[model samples]
Target: MSRALRAPMPDLFLGLISGTSADGIDAAIVRFEDGAGRLRADLRLGRTYPWPEDLRTQLVALGQQAAPLTLDDLGELDSRIAEGFAQAANRVLAEAGLTAADIAAIGSHGQTLRHRPQGRHGDGRHGFTLQLGDPSRIAERTGIRTVADFRRRDVAAGGHGAPLLPALHAALLHAPGEDRAVLNLGGIANLTLLPADGAAVRGFDTGPANGLMDAWCLRHTGQPFDRGGALASSGRIDPTLLARLRAAPWFALPPPKSSGRDQFHLDWVETALTGHEAPADVQATLLALSATTIADALRATQPSTVRLIACGGGVHNPALMAAVADALPGIAVVSSAAHGLDPDHVEAMGFAWLARQTVLGLPGNLPSVTGAAGPRVLGGIYPA
Candidate 1:
């Protein structure tokens, strides 16, 4: 049970997270070994466990509900969500033929119930980003040290505390003398720019990615997501709707801004749907919205080369991918898989690396990408 007898920290680490969509939990068991004086990480195995439909609905509502939830209600939801995270961690361990003792630590990004990344955030601030998965519960249940609350530490240090995977993006994917952009189209879309000349990295959310499209799909089709962009492919894009949706201030805002369900919810979509448009057409327009915003963000980054590699659930959507490719003429759009990484598991793998960083007293946040005042070690440890 002591550190002296346990497996070496570099042997393995586990990462668990559920994105803004509240759709499911992504779990990855990663192998890290010393490679030429640097720790090398390879994702050994990963899987996604969807949130129960009912609980998913509750968390979605609680995320941006104007109606306040009681303290007891909030507490109960937090515990339940942590229990779900624990379940996913246990499942990943079993699938990978590993035990808690085999892992040095488990990094959990948790479920973001509300992420207020700006405006007086920290321990005493009224508004602060909150991720709800009790690390204590995770450590207790998994019998492994858990590193979580990775965001607030950065936020407290005057950072956006989001899109943290860019550190791993630079680590795993960055190539010398090659300008590349990594885009993650989760519930929200964010862009990370890696310059060929080793310039400071820049990244920010590009507005609604799958979040709006998924919401619209759920409302119209009763499915959680529009599988493979079929709905969009079947429908026509409404230009007027597209213009209205893009008019939001977030698009024009410079780098370092982040958004969540609060900025791109169904109510916002309803407001955008002023005229009578076919539901499917709106879906098509939403897809276009994601593509256009992502394209625009990459354009703003304006790397020496327009080589863009995309990751996340959105990468699975053919229509969206096509739209993005079409938006950026002459640029080759590729999946992260081409670079030896599964799109769905990149974020989870990043957190596993982050956990290792925390355990070893290394800095995990990128000040250039996060807009943090400076680089600082992130996350608090919850030991088993």
Candidate 2:
């Protein structure tokens, strides 16, 4: 469909998501407009609300598969996460001086617990991805329509059910005559490939981003993260360790792949260690791994990419960004901020755009990105 002929859509939407980092709930209120034969999103407000300490600890443990969970435990965690998400929504709304009625709907990309796009047996048939935080509760608490569970349907259709933001990236960042890619450096890094020829967008998880780095940082420095990659900068990259980390089988998988903390936690990192490496060196090597893997993927899959626009938490880490730029010598590395989007809030804003898509009955996933059977409208709606 021509951009000029697209139907008008509701302007205001709230997006909520707690990424694999389990850092906090990112909430964004967006106003979308149709302009110049294209859709544009104006982020009216964005905020990250911290999780209750205990809830955060449990979430991290569950995400890393560090703690075993029973059905009852899962139920409790689900409700608590929903309550946390609801609180985040209300807080952002209050700070913006807006009532629930002022927004069109909420798009909640609930907290992901497990994401097995290829299933346990390496077959697509039994694959499933799970995200918690009940949208029904979100709708009830926020007194607004809600859209959640955005991934499972794609997984059911034989897709990875992740890297869902590529559609939004393509819509907002695609440059018609220049091959570009958007790299999201969240807990796990993923890339959205945008070809200059107007071909279908493609995306997938590249590998570990901040998730492993942060985990190792916290374990060594007692800091949640290495703030600006200071710790990593203080050490040298251990080549042997870096090589071992790079040899992980997942890295060999082709596109349409996805991963999470469940796959690349501290344990996964430890398995590659020789017990003689310094903590700082390990941190440095991990940072190098993220940069190298991202560069490798781009070179192997989209070598023609001229510009790489980066977003998400890792963008704030200068060491990582510099490493990426160094690794991809010919590509221009820039931030989404340069294009009018908040680096930290792009994913949250994406969910808001997704909510609007669900309300309009528009397809959200890119089959090329997720390996889904085809484009399909994502998410289930919970009316206010």
Candidate 3:
């Protein structure tokens, strides 16, 4: 860790993302400063702009592989998502009293529609991931330079191209003498391991975080998500159902792995159901599956990790957080807020950091984490 010093005039970057949940577009205006081998990110403002219901519905359906999509459908969805992202960027800029001129670049993670890092044959070759929200469209609409399509480069380099936030996690939250792990509990949960001895940082997806739970909650309760995880908290965890979920072959796979709604959607959960359990109990079991998988991955990979800093929307769920805490007996589990990072916007902020890296021609993906051939600059830049 570099000594904290007064930062000079910082660069402002806007980050936009809509995770697998497709709930909304998270827009973060982040101010970054680099000095003394230290990089700092201070959130100027962060907001989640709701997606138009029809578009969001289409996104959810397509993401879950529940809806068929033609090439025209793909093109239309891509343009619509880019328009949505541009709208969100403009709205956040207005709210922050800034304009495109004030921002160095907009980093759009886009909406991931499919992620198959191991390919359809379970082999490492021919893997690809898709994130829709065109950088060209974003730049054209916002009049700001944009960096998008950050994942495919790593996939092309024989990497998972998921869990790309570990580089940013290490920069912002890594402590010198503390073996800490950063867990991003988005639609999927991913863990970034930062060792005290400065070993290579490693991270990988641990499976469903909020994606399955949110989908299940919406299907059964008509609510988009389990508010405060109240529905889950009111139910009992079905041990049998949890065992079936935990038996997934993906969980047994080693590091350099990733998954998304395409792999762990409502259908996946439904297949594991015994047909005798209540909807609430199923919800409870899904929550348990997330907690246990996260804990199991951590224990298997980095047993010495004493602190777990969690971020993403799942951090707001008291039930999920408590469940994770219960699963990890000795680990100090806490939200990223404990370390001065907003739990909701950590990922959005990470894209901001990634954009800065791309603008500076620096490598963004950690080869150890992604299993890339070597350090490679990720993403393409679109001029305003």
Best by lDDT: 2
Between candidates 1 and 2, name the one with more favorable TM-score: 2
lDDT of each residue in 18-100, candidate 3, tens digit only: 99999999999999877888778899999999999999889888878899989998899999999999999999999999988
Q: Which TM-score value belongs to model 3?
A: 0.96
In model 2, where is the ten-residue run with the lowest total lDDT?
Answer: 3-12
Q: TM-scores, in order shown?
A: 0.95, 0.97, 0.96
Q: Estimate, for each residue in 198-278, the C-alpha lDDT of model 2 and write its tens digit.
A: 988899999999999988888898888899999999999999889888999999999879999999998888888879988
Backbone N/Cα/C clashes per model? 0, 0, 0
TM-score of candidate 1 to 2 decimals? 0.95
Candidate 2: segments with Cα more than 4 A from true spot: 1-10
Candidate-wise lDDT, in order: 0.85, 0.93, 0.92
